[model samples]
Target: MLTRSFPRLATLRYPLVLAVALMATACGKGTESTAPAASTPAASTAATPTDTAATPAAATAPAQTRQPGPIVPPQGPAPVLGTDYEEIPGGQPWQPEPGKVEVVEVFGYICPACAAFAPTVEPWHMKLPADVNFHYVAAPFGPEWIPYAKAYYASEQLGLVDKTHMALIDAIHVKKTLPGEGDPVNEQKIADFYGQYGANPKQFLDMMQSFAVSTKINQGRQFMQKSGVTGTPTIIIDGKYRITGGKSYQDVLRIADHLIAMERAAMAGTPAAAPAAAPAAPATGTGG
Candidate 1:
């Protein structure tokens, strides 16, 4: 069975199953959700009936990622330091720029949890204050993850990230047009995938293997190590804190908002009040 091919995906399946369940609940609540317009045969052989029995939990990937709605700042007390987030000792921004508060996400395109979080985080990131900077650092957890990480940097180099970021996620998770888990990892196939978005396949492949991309991959690896990031969908606030626990993805963003506010205030010379101690929260299942 295809699940046997990538045993590591045991951690990735929970979020996929959860996303599908949430989609069902939203429909029951009378909220209509639209699946992506593009439909293609699933790349995973695991989706076949013969293999589906092995990983029944993740048979149906979420049809629709949660849409961006009104930006409601999380309503609650400030996030507690130890319970909500952890400080990254001696950490520094992945790419520092003066006067901008940096928020970086260490994620993997192949990781289902990161796929689930993308729809939620992308909207929040879009609404960030002008003084705040949001960056994505692709996590290269294994061989299957490296090509997509390279694709990210290459797309970044070609100024295609803004256009292709969400689409790539959709291709991998929803449409399943591109290779993800339980599928052969082909660099050329990934390059051809970008060709549809105006990038020449040959040139995209060259850029993927370029020195600039390699440097970024290495830099991102070192940053994850220093920040003590252990999983995908992990958020880093100003490189000083790595969000460790939250009851939900919303709670994760809520904690991120609190931390961003604190950072914003600190920058303006008006530090926010210390948050009261709260009991430790459950780990938001970030796919390892």
Candidate 2:
């Protein structure tokens, strides 16, 4: 099980405050990926520029995204510690089981960046090597974001995340069902969206509020805080490294794949693949 930091009451309130500022700062982080880009939801639009040069050709034209890319070996200098990637302070990656490396994505349905990053993450996650274990941790940034996280956790309990993951994003970003801001989340409407996926509205709604799901949400919040994740779409590798190359959404995965290779080798007792030295302090930068 994952560990939590905040007390129950305070944890519930923190997301409301942090979410407000996060949207503003996050605007400066990544590209907004949507059709007829001008109409992109305000929250999902890219507010600032990142290193799009690192965005490979496949990401530029997602039509070819499913084509498997070459599996480059992890060589050359390691990613600059404390810069490219930051280590969690005295923390271990939250692995689900032995024989697999943990990959947790911190995202929010309301985050435009997360919506934009979804396309890249969706196909990429499926192609991951067998030794890597991937996870999605929804950010409970506010009243709007909290409902999505609750829904995601509910899906997790029902073994339906794969079924609902991209569909939720499409409903909001593509169909424009969910508002970007200025309106409270409509639970019934969101429930209706899930209903189409065969989730009984009552059962799904009840699952979201179940004690078990609540605990997972709390644990996710604590994990974000510990790992220096300040926005949607941040990635934590093996609970130790936060991919911070800040190149592009695609670069996030590129760096993560490299880290996975390194971790994989280390697990094999390869002395040449020593882990990066621990950082003196945990990163204070946002995961944007």
TM match of model 1 to true structure: 0.73
**Whole-model lDDT, model 1:** 0.65
TM-score of each: 0.73, 0.71
Displacement of residue 160 (Cα, Å) in model 1 is: 0.7
- Model 2 TM-score relative to the real fold: 0.71
Per-residue lDDT tens digits for candidate 1, residues 98-125, read 8778999887776655665666667678
Please tell me which predicted candidate would have the highest lDDT against the true structure: 1
Number of clashes in model 2? Answer: 3
Model 1 lDDT at residue 87: 86
* C-alpha local distance difference test of each model: 0.65, 0.60
Question: How many residue pairs clash in model 1?
Answer: 0
Where does model 2 exceed 4 Å of error? 1-72, 75-77, 273-288
